[model samples]
Every structure is written in structure tokens, then in C-alpha cells.
Target: MDKVLEGLKYAAAGAGGLFAYLFGAWDALIIALVIFVVADYITGIAKAATQGKLSSAVGFKGLLKKVMIFVLVMVGTVVDKAIPAANHAIRSAVIMFYIANEGLSILENAGELGLPLPKTLKSALEKMKDEKPEDVPAEEQE
Candidate 1:
């Protein structure tokens, strides 16, 4: 039992290290993205269930898309590493873009579920959703 417990601890640390390496630091932006991703997924299911349109295939596809968001983040990290001057700019942009995107989706799901949303919040998210990271000037990004 002692040996097994020690092995488990090593495995957990290895997994965590890999995750951090792949996703960069586990900062507030990452935390927000995680929360928004999970909330959006849950709200999506609720919205679909309420509309009687819930399907396993669609749900699986949604899961795939969510996974892809992280995959893109990994790609961004790779790019940042390649361009040392970037200083995690690419990864940060990817995370921020997805955070905005997922937040908007969550709001939409809430609306579908007959939940009232603040107009200002919705408009702000919409604006963020429309702004592509590449379109932002490099100076503004810094």
C-alpha cells in the first residue's frame, strides 16, 4: 500500500507538470477560461434539454469543440516558445479569445433557457466576441 501511494503521488505530479507545460501557467485567465468552458457546456446541455433537442451526437461534438479550444491554446504556447519576443502573447490571446467566445455562448444558452441577461453584459460580450485577436494592434496587446 505504501509503494502504491508513493507511485500515485508521482503520477499525479507528472500529469500536473505536463498540463502546465502544455497550457502555460495556471493563471487567472486560464482559470476563467476553464470556468467559462465548463459553465458553457453545462448551460448548453440545459438549453438543449429544455428545447427537447438534446442528442448524444451533438453533445459529443460540443465536447470535441471544447477540447479543440485547449488544443489551440497548446498550439499558441508552441508559437510563443518559437517567438521569444512574443512573451506568451500568442497563448494569452488565444485564451482571451476563447474566454470571450465561451462567455457569449453561455449567455446565449441562458437566453435560450429563458433567463434574462443584462443588456450591457450581452453587448460587451458580443463586442469581445467580434474582435479577433489578430486584428488588435501589437501595442494594444502589450
Candidate 2:
């Protein structure tokens, strides 16, 4: 029992533990975000192939941006750690922001592939997508 507890403590000092701790979303958020990521990537690839502009560089950049969404999740975690009361709000907002962005990208990818998309979700995502950046004003830009 003592050995196991010590091992657990040390394991968390490494990247593998950190990755899980940081990226492991709650049950609902986990399902939704994982689905969002996979669907968005697949749709993006389809869009690229259809447009005859499939470059690995562009795809990689897109992947990096997607990865940054999770990085932002870690940002929320850090914020929560710093300010405990804001934990729930920060986590929800971060998840919502990424979900909205991913949802928008999925819609864009669909349009790029000439598929008809629902207007309402696209518009909602547009609004949600715009809100986050605007909330951080010029003074905070530094």
C-alpha cells in the first residue's frame, strides 16, 4: 500500500500523467469533444481533397490548431487552480468555446465539400466563436 501510493505520486510528475490529468474531459464533454475532433478532421480532409488543395502543411497546421483547443483546456485548468470559485464557469466556457469552434469548422468543411448545412447551428457558432476573442479587450492584449 505504501509503495503504491509513492509510485502514484511520482507517476504524476511525468508527461503521461500530466496529459491524462489535463486532457481528460468529464463524461459528457469527453464524448462530445472527441466526436467533434474526429468529425472535424475527417470533414476537413474531405474538403481538402475535393478542392484539390490537399497539402500536408495545411493539414498539419489545422491539426496544431485543433491541438491548441486542448491546450486551452489546460489553460482553463490553470485558471481554475489559481481561482477556485471560477472553476465551473471557466471549464464550461472553455468547453463551449472549443465546441462551438469545432462545430463551426465542421460546418465550414461541409460547405467546402458542397454539402448543405443547417444555418442555425452555424450562426450560433459564429456568435459563440466571436464572443471569446472580443471579451479580451485591447488593454488585456499585452
List TM-score per model, in order. Answer: 0.86, 0.72
Backbone clashes in model 1, listed as residue pairs: none
> How far in Å is the alpha carbon of 109 misplaced in model 2?
1.2
Report the CA-based lDDT of candidate 1 relative to the real structure. Answer: 0.87
> For residues 30-109, what per-residue lDDT tens digits would candidate 1 score against the true structure?
99999999999999899989989999999998899899899999999989989999999999988888888888888888
Instruction: Give residue 121's error in model 1 in angstroms.
Output: 2.5
Candidate 2, residue 70: Cα displacement in angstroms equals: 0.4
Worst 10 residues of 2 by lDDT: 133-142
* Best-matching candidate per TM-score: 1
- Judge candidate 1 at residue 67 and give its lDDT: 96
Give the per-residue lDDT digits (tens) of candidate 2, residues 1-142. 9999989878866766666567544457756877888899889889889889889998898788778777887788777767877845686678777777788888878887788999998888778765657776634211
Which residue pairs clash in candidate 2? none
RMSD (CA, angstroms), candidate 1: 5.6
